[model samples]
Target: MGSNFFHHPNGWVGTTPWWKDAVFYQVYPASFKDSNGDGWGDIPGLISKIDYLHQLGVDVVWLSPMFESPQKDMGYDISDYQAVYARYGTLEDVDQLIEACHSRGMKLILDLVVNHTSDEHPWFKESRSSKTNPKRDWYIWKPPRYDSDGNRMPPTNWRGYFAGSTWTWDEQTQEYYLNLYGPFQPDLNWENAECRAAIYEVAMRFWLDRGIDGFRIDTVNKYSKRTDFPDAPVTCPGVPDQPAPEMWCNGPRIHEFIHEMQAQVLAPYKAVSVGELSNTPLPKQVLPYVSAAARELDMVFEFSMIRLGTGNLFHGKYMYTPFPLSVLKRHVATWQTFIEGTDGWHTVFCENHDNGRAVSRFGDDSTPELWEASAKTIALWQATLTGTLFLYQGQEIGMRNMPASWGVEEYKDVESLGFYNEAVESGDEKRVQAILHGLRILARDHSRVPFQWDDSPNAGFTGEGVTPWMRVHDQYRELNAANQLGDPESVLGFYRKALGLRKEHRDIFVHGAFKLLAPQDESLFMYVKESGEQVGLGADGNRKKALVVMNFTSRVQRCPAISGALGCRKGDERLLVSTLRSGLARGRVEELRPWEGRVYLNFQP
Candidate 1:
């Protein structure tokens, strides 16, 4: 009956300047829209779609890399830090994109790939030309070891993030270049203060000067490295892989580097940073970036749920295993405890440009009706959680996973290809199947599919005969945003309603304590959000309190037992929204239909 408490030493919970309670929509520019009909998406095309995002009820937009690149890893390979890819558009086009987003009251978060750059980058080109080049120390380069046969060997046993050896021999320099990811994505030497300062200066000025929002720091955890450069002791053997990237990931001075960057660049601008700290655990590893004291990153995108294993027998070895529902509960619980105790912020998302669709990954896709209910239920969960909820473009309409039949040829992700090659070379059919199983669930290419704007030809992404860089999902005909916008009960509508709830009651949902009242029940995910008397725009506009309840299963499930509140009798429950079934008379105890969710007012106003 008491209001939920909020502890804020800095400022009001929801009134922070950097997107404290906003919903973010991610745009993978290459697949978002195409203006010149050049068969690829560009910035001008994104500018044309700002209206769509506004209507979708999002206040922040996170764009995948638009920097000038060789398209080797899509746009993740940066060739020019300040320039925009001509294929996507010019620098003018990027400037216009930022302008248009702000004009609509939306913030743009640029994706910064500082961990590595394309080999063709002028800096890298010069560094690799000769051992004594002026930029030779710009990247992580070392002399090769003379083997027993007098042949030079790689300096260490570091594994490439994209597969193969982390060290690539450079014939010109007679040395080896350190590559954490693809061979072309040579690692930057953060130990070199000059290299670090140059990138920070460019990034800060590029945005601070233009008044852009902030950045989504790509692989922010991977910038630091050990001085010894010792080989990682293999935990899982026969997998001649980088034994442990701990030697390089989250190194000694990463925090210092980030703090310096924050002091010079982010803090002055009051900008947001969503650090992409993949392959790292939350709470222990990811939470520091968003701590109030760190002042480094505003939020961190944790990948616990996104790494779940699908129904693949060979999931773990290939890193594609659908984690069970229990794993989801444990992860969420861990995050909730940390945020509740600290002045830390978290980013909530089911899908991004890097993971598979939510409904397909988490839903019990045995039937269509369950799919619909599950989608709405998940959206309700996303809305109520105390963080910035990011919805991938197609997620609004409940898009499912790419076809199971999609072969290796249909995939474009470097990670997936590398795993496949490793599996095939091992000559183990069982391992190959297991690896592909994991790839089916976690590959970045899943969320990179074209936006399902309408049921038009090619999902209206490109003209006929102009094949997209990746295959357009076939479900676009039935699942595009155009049709859903008009339907009251569509997934798109449910998302709009979810955002509307946050907009209507930002205090409680965004800034209040999150308690899972019924976490163990297999049928439901019930929780409550309570804001103190000083709070406004929470679950209860009145000084009264509100209780949030959701039924994750598809069956009429009753609350175990309660005294102060029952189902609907006494007008005690003001049903705000329901996914499966609604309409209950006052003073009656009842059950929730399968896959149903409802928010109720707990006390009298």
Candidate 2:
């Protein structure tokens, strides 16, 4: 309904930059591709796939950790600060990745995991070498409790993010070091100025000088903890056993640390930051990090929306539960309202490395017939929302979740395996069942399955002769980029169109004010993105407007036309995009088929 290029009233809506306008595609290096016959994906593999990304219409690529590590947490636990992982190639391979991306007019960013390092890291090795070692203070270490008796407990009642006690005793040094995650991954002490400065160098100077664009800050909210080092408070009302990460998440001085990092590094390079803030639901806890005045981060990712719909009776995140459409509506609407016209910004993503496949989690991907419609419906929603669109690799092809019959042995994620062992030790079959179901639905492995590039053996991800790092999802034949790339009705083709529309209509999709139009209906998630008064025909091309009505259920819904609800004339609404054959008519009446989404426009040239 407008020109090929749409500009905001000003150069941008409100000092917005390319970060807010670009379409993001996340790549998990271990599974994206294998350049060498080694089965594991490397930087050169990513470089080889750059043209595929450009052809798919993505402008920004966010890679998961590719640094040197023990693979305990899939590279999340850093062993070396400046070198790339041996399996993922060398430092020169990383340089080639940056250059290749820039040549294609795209930006590449690495995952910044500074909150903790692998126990094998030189800093931790020396820190645990002896209590008096100069590097001992680099990590959070304390003496065991009950000094009077030989037997003792951990310093506090804190819990690890993966499972068991957060404190691990070091045989070399009598003191216990805090490890909020896996046993091999110890938390770094940000209060120590030296530790802070060194992490700053890793996050700022080193990579920035290497020609990389920016970072997706990992566990950004957990960088600081209370000086008193008290026990973490329980999060749920009755679930006392749950890890109380609330004590460290959004801690007292986290903002200060981020502000310093931003001032020292980000400002100079004009780089962007998208912080992954987890384990909290309060908007107040997250807003400060992304507020422009706060100078902490450019964008903040809150998990409440994804959390509220997942989990079983045991916890809120790990277990599986059908996502209620009404809950998602409320959660997303709250975020959209909070960041409107403010210095802060929002991020839209249905799945990441930590989450499950969107088509399987939120949409109905139980059968072959439901796959295409379901994936397109959710992908369109993410692309049109008023924020940056983060699309995980293989999402464009509607990759399904792990096989239903597969056992936990098929999973490689440290958190999933660790928690499963804990449940098995408790001798609680019910708890074990919940954990297994949760792993199938919400585990990190669900998204970690190899990216399906084609129909070859191993889905064209790794060499046929080599074994992939993780098992590829079994349904790669029916759903893969090579098969769906040209089919207009295929999920991959739909994604290309959605991404193109987002780029062409940035003003309407990225800057236009968002309003939830049909909040009362649990079966529908309907909203509008418009900027100016809804006048009659012949409006200026600068007036960006789009009305999106989505049926999130599996059954056909009798959706009444809301021309009035969207402040448009009966005939002004013109269907621009739809997953169903029967698109929206010019009037106030209609029905949406299962998992159908329709976008309407105001004026057409």
Best-performing candidate as measured by lDDT: 2
**C-alpha lDDT score of every prediction, in listed order:** 0.75, 0.80
The sequence of per-residue lDDT tens digits that candidate 1 reaches over residues 94-170 is: 78988888898887888888999999999899999888887889998988988689977789877766767889999
Candidate 1 global Cα RMSD = 4.6
Residue 39 error for model 1, in Å?
Answer: 2.1
Estimated TM-score per prediction? 0.91, 0.93
Clashes of each: 18, 0
lDDT score, candidate 2, position 314: 30
Off by over 4 Å in 2: 1-15, 147-150, 233-242, 312-316, 532-544, 581-589
